[model samples]
Target: MNSTKGSMINEKKGRIGCVKWHGDLMDTRTFSNAGQDLYVRVNETILAQYAKSSGSLTKKAKLAISIVSVLLFFLVVFLVYWLAKRKSKGKERPDKFVSRVLTGSTYFEKSTADLDDENTINSSELPFFNLSTIYVATNNFSASNKLGTGGFGSVYKGVFSNGKEIAVKRLSKHSGQGIEEFKNEVVLIAKLQHRNLVRILGCCVQDEEKMLIYEYVPNKSLDYFIFNETNRALLDWTRRIFRGDQNEANTNRVVGTYGYMSPEYAMEGLFSVKSDVYSFGILLLEIISGRKNTGYYNETYPDSNLVGHVWNLWGEDNALKIVDSSLVDSFHFNQVARCIQIALLCVQEDPTERPTMSAVLVMLSNDAALPQPGKPPFLVKKSGTIEDNSINYVTCTIVSTR
Candidate 1:
């Protein structure tokens, strides 16, 4: 019985050993699978992190490029502006340069007797009048002989020794025009020989004295008759008689009559033939309304100047109401209306919009359709200051009536 019991114990031990070996094999297989799964997960995580890093780098590079492009654009703009301003400053005025040349030479300082020599002064183009002759003719510039005054100087009625009627323009000592402007005027007027333009007879440039001799017109300037209440009646005849009629003087100084000056000339010191057209338009309006542009104040429309007042009246189809009261039944309505339209076209703020003188003459004579005018430069009065918003700061010179 002891032998049988020992054999059963051995058998039980063998079974236990077999069970332990099987269990060890199962654990080894599970551990190998778990390790493989862990490696796969780590690889996936590394790839994702790498992709994220690459995307962030691309965004940063794009942002940096955008900032650089913006900076370059502003830099180019600033450089261009600075260069243009420098160029403008470098340009010198022609008149100023001419003045320097004249004053720097001793030839201009010669006496009248020396200047009379044929080789001394160029008298072939324009007649050079003797200072003594002009003095006697103008009665030594007597105030009684004074016909009018202009931005240049005073005009005096002079009768030459030969009984020729002439008008003398005496340059003021403090006149805005320098010697160069005087020379320019002489040269410009000499070349032009239009009947409408004042004819130049001679000139005198002796020492500090400078004068111009012109053919005398029996009637005074158009302003004299047009501005006067009673004298305005004669304009109908005057207009019939003279339907056809006719500068950056210096950059350092502005040379023009106030109120009559064009916006380009008054504000930017720029002038052209178009500037003359602007003046003519203002004159036409003055003739039609019989009121000065500088001093016409309406109690009903206190804020409105002559241009603004006329524009308002024109827009409302009440243009005829702005006409001079003196006309009564004498003036033709169609003619007066046409004149107003032409005048408005001439006073356009943009110089290019204003018609040329030749074009103006055609408009006056013909019945061609006219373009509608845009808003004119309405002079605004602010805090005891006149603000012309269309332009930068300007210097104006008040001129005496001629």
Candidate 2:
């Protein structure tokens, strides 16, 4: 081949090399690090050329061989250089502005020690998890790790190097929340301070990947047992709390609302984690203030149920008024305030917004940020308008009784 022809081929090879280099970085499903292994072949190829005798070769033939070999040598050398750089980068961690997304298919240990010195998080600011760390924690977000799927995304179970459990909420590509909106939500969620609410441990937003990290609620979201014959028998609302396992017996009776019954159970014979959360919320409020919700009616707030009265007080910044007067002087106001906010969260009208029993436990244990509670269910006012809440009812009755 002539020099012009040979040069064109090399140029073409260089362009191909460039594509392979960056293409792997951008779309990694097919990425493979075999460059180092191929580097030694260059030496072998060069040495083999000498073994071919030049006794029968003319001067022009010799020149052509040398030119071709030189071009090939440069091309491989440039490839090696590019590959080496990329290979080294595998060990590096991404910056605030992430650029790559990697996928791995390996996991057996519940969790392993693989991360950037503990997510490189400030430990005080909004935590940012490396995509790699999240993958390891959730076993690459395995299907088995999935707890449930919601409108916004899917939730998966995870564990850390210390065997600490966590929940990962991976948002879908079409979730409609862009990077900016997600960032804003993260910031707002971080500012909240409570235990019952979902605690944000960290988050990952790399390239097209977006996920939120939370402490795993082992017992699970809400109580689905008040309906189960066995569970219903095992627990009474007065003693047993919401543990969303399954079922509720006695489909033949009207177990009237104790004010602790969630709306869904009351109206639709439906129950879920959130529905039970509503029931728990009422119990929580009653316990904190030493007030009985079943017959709660104050002259100052005659038109409101216990849930609404507290919500109104909360809006008026006077929720502490609902605290048990007997213990007010002996308790920490901040702690009590946090509990009130958490109770409100549990009692939220929308079952979807209510925290699960596991979340309630987290709220009681961790110092996670708390969101402002919305109006509770069955909120009534002097104007005669009523705002209903998600409910699941449980009454003092029997499985075969009417």
Candidate 3:
């Protein structure tokens, strides 16, 4: 056998040969001369060149991977930084909005100035006057000028030095209205213009003090004349009672006289025409008995108000015994009892069972045997404090969650 090395091309050749190698990078060739024995050739120069080229390609692949990893790391850092910046801005937005409201115009007005016309805001008459202005106008909230107290706070009659009459409704310190809510109400009232709704003149907001100012229209509240004995005889209050209806809306903040609040509205913030029916029932009972429904105490029933006491009298067929002395001889016994039944119907625990104002009119106008009422909602002391028992019902609901 003849052996040649380092070159594939032999100076002399005759026969071809090939063999597999198990474990090394090898470039092999076979050769023969003049039909002699087979010859082998190994080219180390080509093998070295291939090895160097492979190493160079491997190094290039590693460098490319390292560059990609570094670029990805920087991208992650940039994304995190951007998200943090956005979150910080979000945290600042509410404070900025409130600052704008307190100092001058609200953020909404400023932001939407280009999009909305100045005349579109029905707030030209609504002055966001300072607390000092209201303080002076209200004579430091003297008790003598106070119109009446409400569920939220006391209302005072304010006469400006210029002889403008204004009503100042001072919000209680314990009231749960936050600045956000107060701001929203200010904006909403400013935009509303209606005769039925007393025109809101302005608001007063200062350190721990919030008061709503309304244009004073001289008229006593319905409760005033209804509960007053001397004034009760002047007008046929029963016929003048059923007034009007409105589309009911639910609110997070429930505000009304304690005695007048409905079960669903008082406890769960759910209100509808049924709520009006509940209030009307209270009024009806008051009118018939010439008594206020709120503070009336019954020695027979502990922690029970006018509703529970009336319910007891009603169940026992002694309903007329609970009537006002002034009304006792004036109206027929049957008529008074029937009115009690209608009031009970209005104060039913289930809103659906309560008669609408229209139905109430029919019942009052006719002597039809009225349908029986469900249990009326009342306050009872289970834990030493008067608490509402209306939440035990399975079906009571608010409009929806915020």
Candidate 4:
């Protein structure tokens, strides 16, 4: 019994020794794991701080680039504007005379009304000639100095003291619509600047007297050459140029020459840009045929006018017969035919059927297919009695026989 007890005590001591060794191993493993965790946390904190610093630097760089780009863009725009302004200034030199005419005021701030007086004429930028100067230039309105007369007024040839030649249009006192016509001439001519249109040099308005000075057209009006048998030869190989205004002006009374007046204008007193076109068509026919529409009467077709005569000839395919005898062989056949077609198109009774001036120019320049023309407005035979309507027709009889 004593030997058995000693053996059990030895086994108990061995077991206790084993448990203490296992506990020591567990403590060592726990300490190693804790140290590893601490190192990982420290690395994570350092990485976060470095990333924040990098992000801040990137934002600053982007901001700097944006500011620089905007500055460069503004600088480029400013430079371009400055250069353009400088160039335009160099090209357009402001003329004092033109400026004064446009503004209706001189350098002295004197109004047109003030400048109208002969004493204050020096204040005008436009060459202002007093009544005395004009009188001396035109030889006191001598009959021999008269160049021509028109619906508006009579034109006189004037020679200045300095030997400058001028054509002066003296408004007639007998003309009831002279004031309105004078105003229209001044306003209209002053604004126009074209090679084909006559240039207005200056004007004179002194107590019941109004006159316009124009650059002398040596060849005279188109009608002078186109109408005259001897002068018509001079127009060979030369194109007749005519300018038409698109804007229409309404008048209370009809105030144009008899032959050139459109049917609508003559009868109803309704005039438009198309009316001018109609008149131009008549003029064109006159130019081509070398015959006046009103004055010329065909004994064969006693009732037929120039327009009717051309239309009939065109239908018969013998339109070339109507061409001026002098220009028949000289002028281009194709061009003359095209002009006749264009003229017929222009004189169509329906104004909308006619082509615009731009289209006419295009057709004149190119060989495009032209649209068929409708019936032209028939010219009324001048009987002693009025034909269409009972409307009072007051003829502005200042005829141009130049």
Residue 160, candidate 3: C-alpha displacement in angstroms? 4.5
**How many backbone clashes does every candidate have?**
0, 25, 1, 0
| TM-score winner | 1
Question: Which ranking of candidates, highest TM-score first?
Answer: 1, 4, 3, 2
Better of 1 and 3 by TM-score: 1
Clashes of 3: 1
Tens digit of per-residue lDDT, candidate 2, span 1-402: 001111111122344221112111232132274321111112344455644544446666888999999999999999999999989776544333332221121111222233345763443244567778888888988999988864346779998776778877777777643444344345444433244344556667665687777666564322323323344344433222222321121121223344556777666777666865675677567656655565455677787777878888898898889865445445677778888999999988778888878878899787789988876777763243222433232222111101
Q: What is the lDDT of candidate 1?
A: 0.62
Question: Candidate 4: which stretches are off by over 4 Å?
Answer: 1-128, 176-180, 187-195, 239-255, 385-402
Model 3 regions more than 4 Å off:
1-127, 130-133, 148-151, 160-164, 173-199, 206-209, 217-219, 222-259, 294-299, 329-335, 365-369, 379-383, 386-402
Runs in model 1 deviating more than 4 A are 1-122, 174-184, 187-193, 237-255, 381-402
Whole-model lDDT, model 3: 0.61
**lDDT order of candidates, best first?**
1, 4, 3, 2
Candidate 1: which pairs clash? none
List, residue by residue over 55-171, the lDDT tens digit for candidate 3: 999999999999999999999999999999999875554334344444554422312232113212233233345666677778888888888764446779987666778887777
Evaluation by lDDT, superior candidate among 2 and 4: 4
